[model samples]
Target: MYLADGLVPYTEVFSVLDWWKVAGTRYPTLRKVARDIFAIPVTTVASESAFSTSGRILSEHRSRLTPDMVEVLMCSQDWLRNKCKGEQIM
Candidate 1:
């Protein structure tokens, strides 16, 4: 019951003896067989929607951006992303 109800994707992963290696570092029986297991190349960006919000918040051209502007941009981003769902993304 524990295995069935306690876990979802991790359980699916652990079913394989190879992936079970992630659970315990001491267990030398299993190695990292799932090297390129990630469906996406990167996990952090995949978890997010778009970098447009980031772009308005940060500038690569200049390093003198103020912290207050960054904060306001972040707040606007969170609000728009969460509340303005039906609006056209342009």
Candidate 2:
């Protein structure tokens, strides 16, 4: 049913998020998934930074760290950075 619907005019909506917010009630399941997917904050960091960070984190001395540990470290680093920025803003 969703795919059959006509495309929304760009003039009527500011963004995909806005469109979802308005039309979501008609498709409850899809809306839930879309909400979860869109809730993630977008990052502006360059791709090079990710490569360099991973390289440093997985250096020979740290190569034995499990994939789960690597994920935890990356998420923790990002959370800490965001927290510090929020503190600085005040």
Candidate 3:
């Protein structure tokens, strides 16, 4: 049924969420999945900047650290930061 549906007109201000809401009855399973997927917050940060921790984590004194160790440190930092935020919210 979705495949046969016509595309939304360019002039119309159509929202994916709005369409899902109206079509929820027709596509209950898909509507649930779409809701969960769309619930994730959007990020505007560039991938390069978001993943690069080299400047902050790497310095002259820390240059000796292996790549594997650097990766572990980066993962630990992110986990701790997220854990702290979760604690504060509760």
Candidate 4:
């Protein structure tokens, strides 16, 4: 069994580590739940960024561009954006 120190409220502690150190002693299960939930990764915009760039590259007027050209343009864009140094993307 854990006992609350009552010295500090759990809500007052802003940091995960700080909360664990303070409220964890009083609510170990709740702490574990919070840890697990916090460990889960949030939605990422990285893939969306890539898609957005692709959309810009293949916009309405450029829709006539062939798939091969689109692929090449996208590859070049990615390579330049990432500063990649290697053989061209096939």
Per-candidate clash tally: 0, 0, 0, 0
Ranking by lDDT: 3, 2, 4, 1
Per-residue lDDT of model 4, residues 1-90, tens digit only: 454434554464368686579777778798888889989998767864754563467668777999998888777677775665664555
Candidate whose TM-score is highest: 2
> How high is the CA lDDT of each candidate model?
0.54, 0.76, 0.77, 0.71
lDDT of 2 by residue, 1-90 (tens): 788888876684378766767788887888988878878999987965764464568878888999999899887777767686785422
Error of 2 at 28 (Å): 1.1
- Clash count for candidate 3 is 0
TM-score per candidate, chains pooled:
0.29, 0.42, 0.41, 0.35
Check candidate 2 and list the clashing pairs.
none
Number of the top lDDT candidate: 3
For model 2, what is the alpha-carbon lDDT of residue 38? 78
lDDT of 1 at 88: 57
Candidate 2: residue 27 lDDT (0-100): 79
**Which wins on lDDT, candidate 3 or candidate 4?**
3
- The TM-score obtained by model 1 is 0.29
Tell me the lDDT of candidate 3.
Answer: 0.77
lDDT value for candidate 1? 0.54
Q: Write the per-residue lDDT of candidate 1 for residues 1-90, one digit (tens) a residue.
A: 223534436443445555455543634332333433533366565436554654455567545768887677677776777676876555
